[model samples]
Target chain A: MKRWIPVVLVYIALIAWLLFSVFPFSTTLLIALKPKNAFMKFPPDYFSMKLTFENFKIVLSDKNWIKYYTDTIIIATLSAALSVLVGSLAAYSFARYEFRSKEFLMVFILALQMIPAASVIIPIYSMFATMNLLDTFLILILVDSVSSIPLIIWLMRGYFSTIPKELEEAAFIDGCSGMKAFWAVTFPLAAPGIAASAIYAFVRAFNDYIMARTLAGDRVVTYTVGLTMFTNQYEGVDLTLVSAAAFTALIPILIMFAIFHKHFIIGLTGGALKD
Target chain B: MKKRKWIPILLIVPALALLIFVMMFPLGWAFVTGLKSMTLLDLMTGGGRFTGLKNYFKIFRDRLFYNSLRNSLIFVSISVIGQVFFGFLIALALKNKFVRFKSFFRGIFLLPWIASSVIVGYSWIYILDANLGFLPTLASVSPFLQMLGLNRKDWLTNPSIVIYVMSVINIWKGMPFSMLMQSAGLQSIPDTLYEAARVDGAGAWQRLTKITIPLMTPFILINLIMTTMITFNVYDVILVMTSGGPNHASEVLSLYVYNTGFTMGELGYASALSIILLLVNLLVTILYFMILRYRERRLA
Candidate 1:
């Protein structure tokens, strides 16, 4: 009985923290599942068993919502691919060779990573507006991809460093040119790191609200921006729709996280903490 | 190590060029824009005249600038401390031999961190809205909640405590990153140290303080700095929740910059505010690095 005290206490603490973490999600899920007008009722019926999929169905069938999602997918996917490709080249440069200003350049990139998006947002907005690039997928893609490059470079540099240089040398001996040796040998070996970096960039672009909002408009609405559109002035009328829309945006990312949690953590910490 | 000097440079040119176009050029333009007397309309017409140091001087006198600065300080400090503290506690708790299903607990804990700030903001709104909030709804029935004073309706609207509330939600959303960081730090500490401490009859608290905390200082400092920088820039949740309203009580520096630029059309002043923000970020970063260096020197 005495020994069980500590175990019980630990369980209680864990359960309490767990509840704190999960309560909001459960409540939101509940509200999202409620019938459209049910949430407006006094003393909401959260415990009621009258669940419905009407909200999800409505949101899914809406062409605007569908467009927002597809836009997000395209931008996120392309941004991820572009950042990884470009960032890996830089990462490979850092990993494979010692050059002049290498240390300075690496530190410079790290410092660049710390520049707040909000700080430069005004200039970015003006730059795009001046170039007539605002409201275009190309601008969002370029901006979002650039935002993730520094961290991805650092993360991928770490990955590239771990792969043996001997592998590339062996490929060199087998008549592979420098770039071919990289493509044939080191690239395959660094696939996991590339995947991790790509996903990191994808999530960053997908979750970017401020950048997407500032640079994008009607034709290029990401889900984050679209989620805000559901927030009409008449709060309750769109509350269910907003909730449903928000949840719909959440599912794919949640699924992605669940599938690649290890990569997600590595990416989230910017490779600062590796398991 | 390079036969051709240009090979590495060639490899790096694409990334460097993109960064220059996307990041560096914008930053340079921000400085130029900061010096001008411009608005959103001026931006379109390219008509702002240079007014050197005027916008900078104005920020020093702007009451709202000072207000947002104060709010940002409060928001960043509280969020950082709460996140690191709660994260460390949870990491330690999960490290215990008695804790089971560790990964399951960790995954659930990370949900808030993974979800978009917009979603997180709306979810919390649903939970805290004055009329239809989950807490108020639950409070109507539960005597325990009412006793605990969790029945308040102005959780998002009350100016006085709104910043603090935002800090709490920020903690919920951010603690997992610190947890993962601290967990990695914890793992790096050899188990033999704990075993030796136990052999010496040192209790749990002493073992933690003497062994764990001492070795974990560097990790904690890094965690602190990272969280500080991240939280300083975090206005997304705030944007979605209150839009820095209920009389601008919750507007941090980043959000204030956004509001000033886009909402009020004060593009020039906002550009100046952004430079100030960039300085604040740099100041905090340099301060932490100095502390880090000083600590390393002492340890050495």
Candidate 2:
């Protein structure tokens, strides 16, 4: 009876979580298919008397969406690639080398994670405006990469530290240069960790709003900022259209998670707890 | 090892340079901007004069600033505590052997966190919408509650309760992370420890208290600190949900800073607030490290 109590509680909690999480997604899907007038009924009809694909078609065919989606994809991909390359190198250095200010640098990098993006948004905006790079994809990529570097480094550093030094030492003994050893031996072994860090950087870049909103403005809107267009303060909000856009935005992330589930899980949770 | 000296330096240079140029420089610039008496025109045209601590003093005198800070602290505290408590409970349940389809449950549970905060905010807005919301409908439908004749509450409209509404959304989104960390911590403990306790006739509660709690301390501390930082820094959810509305009752520190700099065009005052947030985060980090060290020494 005592054991059964905990089991019952687990089921109860799972049901509660399901209602909270899945219910929203289902409601969103339902809303996306409903006619605009049906969305505002007094009882708020869940089922559309006549389902329509008009919202989806509109969102998909919009010219601005094409540019927004392309800009987001480019930014996410570039930031992920740059963060992985730079972060892996720095992680390897921290793992393999004993140098002056090593601890200080490590701590400093960790502390960088604490700096709120909001705090720097104004200065970053002004600085970018001065450089004439505001609203450029390059600025978005640079901002995303900078923000993601610390996380990638932390993950890579933790994973690299776990790998034995002797493997690289063996490569060095075989007349491989230090760079060659890292590339041929250490890096390949740390591929899983690298993949994990890359995916993380990608997700962060994709989901980020403040920097993208501040830097890109309307010129290079990301998926997050694009969704904001549906919300105007004084206008009548079409919940159906907004829901459709949100559902569409989630597809890429869900697909990415599906493709790299194991690596993503290990990378994210391992980095969080271990470090 | 001779070439190694420069190789490591070379490896670190690009990341360091990018970080400094993109992140660190802007932060430094914000500090400098805070010390200047710059109007938006002056800042835009590069004709600002120096004004030391004047913006900072102005923020202190502004009542909205204190309200934002207070709301931020309250929101963070409630969200963090709720996530951690529920997370611990979920972790305990997952550790049980009888739980079916564990991996499927874990994946679905993480949906709230993985979904964008803007999406979550909008979703909750639907769930809490006054005329067409689910919660009010459900509340009105319950036979037990209907018998009591309690009125359906307008959760979003009330300034005093909006933070709690926001907190619920945050906890739902964030609790999965703490659960994942705790589960990982749980996996690290050897089964033999539990076996020995069982052989010694210790009850399940005793084993949980004596073994699991102690082993999970490090993970709990890490999750707590990270959650606090996240809650404090959050803006997207608040932006989408309330935009610090109902007379700025739900306005958080970060959102306040954003508005000050961008909306009000008070660059200097916003910079000061940003600096304060940075210092607060730094202090929190230091405090966490100190506690960790103290725990390590006590254990030793």
Candidate 3:
């Protein structure tokens, strides 16, 4: 009985935390489900059963909404692929080589991760503006990929370190060049890290608000920026529609997270403190 | 290890070049811009006069600067403490022997962290808005909630407590990272130590104090500094939720920098403000490292 008491208490606490975690999302969902004018009622009838798919249908059918999705997906995919390709090369070098300033370079890269997006927003905006690169896909891809590289390098480096160097050495002895040996021997072993880093970069780019908002405009509107457009259009009156749009934007990310959460956790934790 | 002396450099060149072009160069440019008296018009006309140290001096005297500094301090401290505390609690609870379906619970906890800030912000606004909010609506019919002071409508507007409210929401979003970190830390601690403690007649509380906290200190410290640095720069959620409204109640330093540059078109001053933000980040980082090293030396 004594043991059961504490166990039950713990379960209650867990359930409470679960409720707290889920409330905002579930409520947002409820708001999204309500009929167009239903939410405008005095005090807003949150428990109303007058739910409809009209909001989701409307948001999904919009042409601009579709464009935002495509833009976000394109930018995110390109940045992910670019960061992983670049970061893995750096990571491999850090993993396999003993070079001068190696420690300094490693620390420098890690410190780069600490640079906040807000700090460089102005300068980056100006630099790209000067190049006539503002609102271009290339600029967003490059900037987003650059932001993710330092962490990806750290993550992929950790993975590369775990693989045996002897495999590459043996490949070298078997008449393979250094680059070929790497691709043939060490690269496949580091696939998990690459996937993690790619997904990390993808999610970072996809979820990016400030960078995309400041740098990109009508030509390169991301879903996040697009959602802001919905809010602006409705002026907070048709929140049901806005909620619907917001929920729609969340779906892809939530789905991705549900599928790759383990990788996400590993990448987040690994990139932070592990040497 | 003998291949070619330049092989590693060759491999690293792409990433290095990207970093230099995208990050380091902009950082240096930001410094230069901060040294000038530039506006958006000046940026177009290419006519910013050199005003070395003038913007920095202006920042020191600006009332908004001091207000934002105070707000950032409160926001970061509350967020860091709340996140670490709740994260530690949840991680500890989940680590208990009776916990089941651990991965499922963890996945749910991570949902908030993964969602875009725009989604988070709008969802929260609807949930907390004074007139149309779910809580205030719920509070209307429930006397119990009224007794608990949950009836207040200005959760996001009131100048005095808006920063605190934002801090709480931030803690909600960020605790998962800390939980993951603390979970990794907990796993690093072997189970045999607990067995040994039990054999020595140590109760749960004693074991926690002696074994868990002391062992978890380094992880906690790292979590603290990381969350601090992150929270200091996390203006996105605030930007989406309030935009530092109702007389600049929740204008954090980073948000202030952004507003100065973008909204007010004071590019040079904003760059200067950002430099100050960077300095604050560096200061916190150095302070934490000193504490970490001091702990390590004592242990040695």
- Candidate 2 local lDDT, B127-182, one digit each (tens): 77777666566566678766775345667889888887788888888888888887
The window of 10 residues in a row where model 2 chain B has the poorest summed lDDT is: B145-154
Give interface RMSD, per candidate.
1.3, 1.8, 1.5
The positional error of residue B63 in candidate 3, measured at the CA in angstroms, is 0.3
Residues A1-275, candidate 2: write the lDDT tens digits. 57788688778887777677687777777778888876566767663368899989988887776677788888999999999999988988998788888898888887676787877888888888878898888998998998889888888888899899999899999999977988898888898899988888888888887788777856788878877776652135588788888888887788888788767776667465432
In DockQ, how does model 1 score against the reference complex? 0.75
lDDT of 1 by residue, A1-275 (tens): 47778777778877888999988878878887888778667766677788889989999998988999999999999999999999999999999998898898888888888788889999999988999999999999999999999988988999999999999999899899988999999999898788889889999899988888888967899999998887763466757778888888998998998899888888878776667
DockQ per candidate = 0.75, 0.62, 0.71
Residue B266, candidate 3: Cα error in Å is: 0.5
Deviation (Å) of B6 in candidate 1: 0.8
Please list the residue runs of candidate 3 whose C-alpha ends up more than 4 Å from where it truly belongs after superposition: A271-275, B1-3
What TM-score does candidate 2 reach?
0.93
Going through the candidates in order, what is chain B's TM-score?
0.97, 0.93, 0.97
| Every model's TM-score | 0.97, 0.93, 0.97
Clashing pairs in 1: none
